[model samples]
Target chain A: MRKIFVCLLVFAVVLSSVALAASSIEVWQIHSPIPEIMNAFDWAAQEFEAETGIKVNMVRIPTEDLHTKLVVSISAGQYPDLLIWNIRPGLEFQGLGVVEEVSSVIDEVGRDNFPTATLTMFQAPLGKQWEIPLFARLAGYHYWKDWLLDAGLDPNPTVLDDGSMVVNAYNTWDDVLETSKKLTKDLSGDGTIDQYGAGFQYNRKGFGDSAAYAFSVITTFGGHLFDSQTGEVVINSPQTVAAYQFMKDIYKSGVMPPGVVAWDGYDNNKYFMDRTVGFIVNSNSVISNVRENDPELADKIGVTIAPAHPETGLRTYSGSPDTMTIFKTDNTDSAKEFAKFLLKANTQVEMFKIMGVGYYGPLLLNVMADPFFSEIGEQERMFVENNKYFVGPEYPGVPSPELITVALAVYNGFVYDDALTRISVDDWSPEDAVKEIEKRVLEMLEER
Target chain B: MENHGGPRLTMMQKETRLGALLLMPAIIVMLIVIAYPFIYSIIISFLRWHAVYPDHPWVGFTNYIKVITDSRFPITLRNTAIYALVGTAGKMIIGMILALILNKQFWGRGVVRGLFILPWIIPMVSAATTWRWMFAEDGVVNFLLQRLNIISQPIIFLGDKQWALAAVLVVGIWKGYPLFMTMILAGLQNIPGELYEAAEVDGANGLQKFFYITIPSLRYVLITAIILSVIWTFNAFNVVWLMTKGGPSNSTHILNTLAYEYGFVGMRYDYAAALAVMTLAILAVFLYFFAKLQKVEE
Candidate 1:
């Protein structure tokens, strides 16, 4: 009896030791395809592992392929312990129960330190936080100073020391359109214009940029994508139709380059970098790229809030909030600990400082007090101010999985951009294009 | 120990058993790699499944019905048909012409052939990207056209809905025709010199010799090449995805890209599987007909 008891004790001890040794967590992160961002995550994982005595496995997926890969991984029953992606898909994943409720983690990290908007956005359906904000992307307009001046126009509409802008020069869509036409010039008596006025990428390719651009336009024109509560299609509203018409007129006006219809998300950035276009509405990456490659050109760059609709006097922009979601895992305790560590204000601020304004801005308001925003230049300030109003298509903001589904549908299907292109390139009437989109969006919502 | 060099079996039977044993590993590998996934996809096609959902309910043919009833289905089907038919026909015609030209006795025929093979040799993604840049509004094609006064305005080759597929087709032909050219050239080389010489002695023209000897000799090769090219072009994902991404209005979406959108972007795995199953069926039917035709001709 004594020998048997000793044997059983040894066996139990061995099993416990093995279980403790196997304690580990795997994370899949999709961020900007930059070494600094990747290295930052690597550093964080190393530090976490060293401090907590847990193994950390980190995998980097390209941003464009993140949605597909995430879906596939979950479908194949290989769920990562954590997934970092944009905020757009959080609700979808949460609805499917792939995401763990991070409320306790949020409390542990001090909920007051994070932004209220982000907190409110994540807490839904079951009053559980599905995703935690990592960083935020604010989309606005960046323009070329030299080109604007050469076109006999003032580039700086409003400049603020607090990283804000209130543009007076191109206040409305009409002003923007007219300015673009003027900036487009025929040099050397050649029939082909040397530079285009505006670069609008209408190609429906990448992660929702085209749809975001369309949403910015439509919302400014007083159009909403869906009745957020009912999930009814509101894409064919008068304001939406008018926005399409405006886009069509711009496409036909010859201010945009001929290949604007084929341009993907990066094309506009490339055009701006090449000095081939006078104006483009994008994140501050354009300015950041110039600052890196050509500091002189960077000085000649201007930043502003995106232009408002000509009639409604409303301005809007689209945001892709960088978020971290913990997947339901066997190592739930380890996963929660990691989330808390990552969201600690100092840790996040360190990451943001390393990434710089080109990659990310502080999602939490308190992180702004961490000297990251205090030492910013003019371009960074512009982005800081723009984040105040940037929201997704389900704006005037009711966050729901159904709303995100509608937005993703329009985005994935390229519905709005397609309508704009049909009107612009194929000579379809705006009404007809809007009608087609309405039908498609409604069908998608119904099917879901 | 069981049967020490026993001659219980006939020699033919022993050889057959040895052959079967030799093929066992390959058969098992095929079953594991190909057959399992193929059967799994077919099974999943009959269910309503979201990747993240816990339950994948068996919906009978409901998934198939949903796929067929999708408004984008008919358009995608039409686009696939156009892409395959046009790409296959164009590649074959261009391949034949190049083969005929290169089959002649020429001083630098080998060098010319090497130059023509560059498109095929270069990677598809790289070639597609280069073509995309070339077809851009301010690209070299437009630049040259503008310099020569061909058009007053630049053309958006990949942007316009009506022309996007055509632009993709041009790139497809550029990348694919070289394979057909090489195959047909080999076929042309195999044609009997005696038949050609006899036809020439009968005062047959170049066209007549091509019609009488070259084409008939190359018929099998042409059919096989066409069938292969059709299969490849129909399932092509990278070129179209890179160049247009089935965009400007979803006008260029083919089966593969559409499947990707549904499965990945939309997260509707069942619908994507159903669509894929249908695409495979369509290709299988075509292969059956084409293979039968080849057999009949033989």
Candidate 2:
């Protein structure tokens, strides 16, 4: 009896030892402050643990505050085992060598399944995969179809041969301005406007949103940000000056809402939801909110490609692929395995569809081809299509660490946005605004 | 060997040793929390290092030169001066007025005091958001102005470069005066009724009694409060950041917000540290004057 009891005790000790030997990884995700997203991550963690027998200490940080916190952590040598953030900071971390190379995982998972552009923007300087994109988002314009109809613009057109409906895209910036001017109206004939035309975020704040708007306009005007190889800021071009002039015209034309200079990221959302704005350029979160709260109004909404530069007839959109990177000091094996698990086509589709509204669109080719993406809804399909073709800063420029560093600096300083605001609100000449932006960009380039 | 020279007192010396031993933990904590970070930032101010980059080379006075020579540095300094002086003076004057009113026996004094503190107690983000909404063109302020027919068109208070700074400063004063009010109120309570009574007996009028008695008694508290408030207002970030974000062509940027822009946003940590060091140097100058005033009061 004593020998039997001793054998059982020995077996239990071995079992506990094996459990202790298993690897445990800590994941720091910046999707918290949203219960639905948090629940999705928590569920993913549980599933991962169940499948791999590896424990994940999932930590949640707010997205807005994550960059500073992550940098501080990295500086103190206390970065998380795995980090998921936007692609620009991932490049910064890659430059700093705080992130581990994950080329093997990409190759193992078959890199061909991911879009070339998505991978190109996130790849390291020396052609190493340091992070894997989990999702992507595009900046585009959404407008009320009824507002367009009220303004006598054909937002929805019928095919001549068949009665199939098609979205009439805004062909030029002038068209948008004209349409917006028409949309701004006094409903009560009291000489006070109850509704405004466009609702672009004009505030000189937020890291990416405001700057992204200005940069997209620059691209639309056929202005090159920097030479792909020379790393020189090329904003002094006629195209660039024209872009500033265009924005100035928009603001001066009184198409945008009054007091737009005070708008933040969420203000445009509020303006749209309040039914005070005819159009807004933002992510699909606006559409999702409208769908959830005002389904009737949501049906009247139409999605279109962003307006093109009148002269150049070009349009460029800004988007950053959302990626997860394994830090250098982490249990890289376990972290990579977990990252791969999250990147699985099925897992991504399920995770993206969380909370009865899909905000994040998948980046992988296989995931893009999935019927789930096609069957989710029309909004989902449009958002995915928009993101798939969106051109980030990496386009028309070399995806060098220097380019990213400068882009981040430019966005952070709000240099161009400030200059544009000076032109639009403060009555500075477009030439002067372009020159000042050029000077600031040059200084920033030299400093970085 | 008459140890009368220094008392040769091992007993007193032993007590001194024990006292220092008792203070060691507190001193260590202070060094860790305050001194270490301060010194580290000062050291970083001399290095040309990005925050996350491991290779930080010593740049000596180059960073300082870079920061000082930058054109925006002078503008930020001027803005900081304006913000600090205006904000401090506004808080002091308004707080004193409110404190005097609240000091008098009045109906619902407790509730009014509580209500005054509400602005200070509310979270800064919430307060800033509320103020921003109120200041919008189509918002409450515009609606009120239109109803009163003050102006034909709604004024974009936050969007106009001319009015943006004033708008932010107004919010700062609104959020800040409560601190001064409460402190001055406490100081006013501490003043003895005898002083006023004696002034009254001496045929002093209301204004004269206030000038002679209340002002003299509250001098110390006012000086301390002004010094603290100046430091705080100089470093205040949220009110401006939330309201205008140094917008409409950098019309509203103060030193702290610029440092944040350069540091966290631009990823130029070394430059940011240099800017911080410059701010500290400027504050030290103010602190010197304040210390002199404090000494005079003492």
Give the winner by TM-score.
2
Error of 1 at A19 (Å): 7.2
Summarize candidate 2's per-residue lDDT along B144-207 as a digit string, tens digits: 9989999889888888877888888888989999999999999999999999898888999999
Among the numbered candidates, top lDDT falls to 1
What lDDT does each candidate get?
0.79, 0.77
- Model-by-model DockQ, in order: 0.57, 0.55
Tens-place lDDT digits, model 2, residues A365-420? 88778777666665555555456346666457664676766666565557766776
lDDT of 2: 0.77
lDDT score, candidate 2, position A234: 80
lDDT of 1: 0.79
TM-score of chain B of each: 0.94, 0.91
> Model 2 compared with the native: what TM-score?
0.91
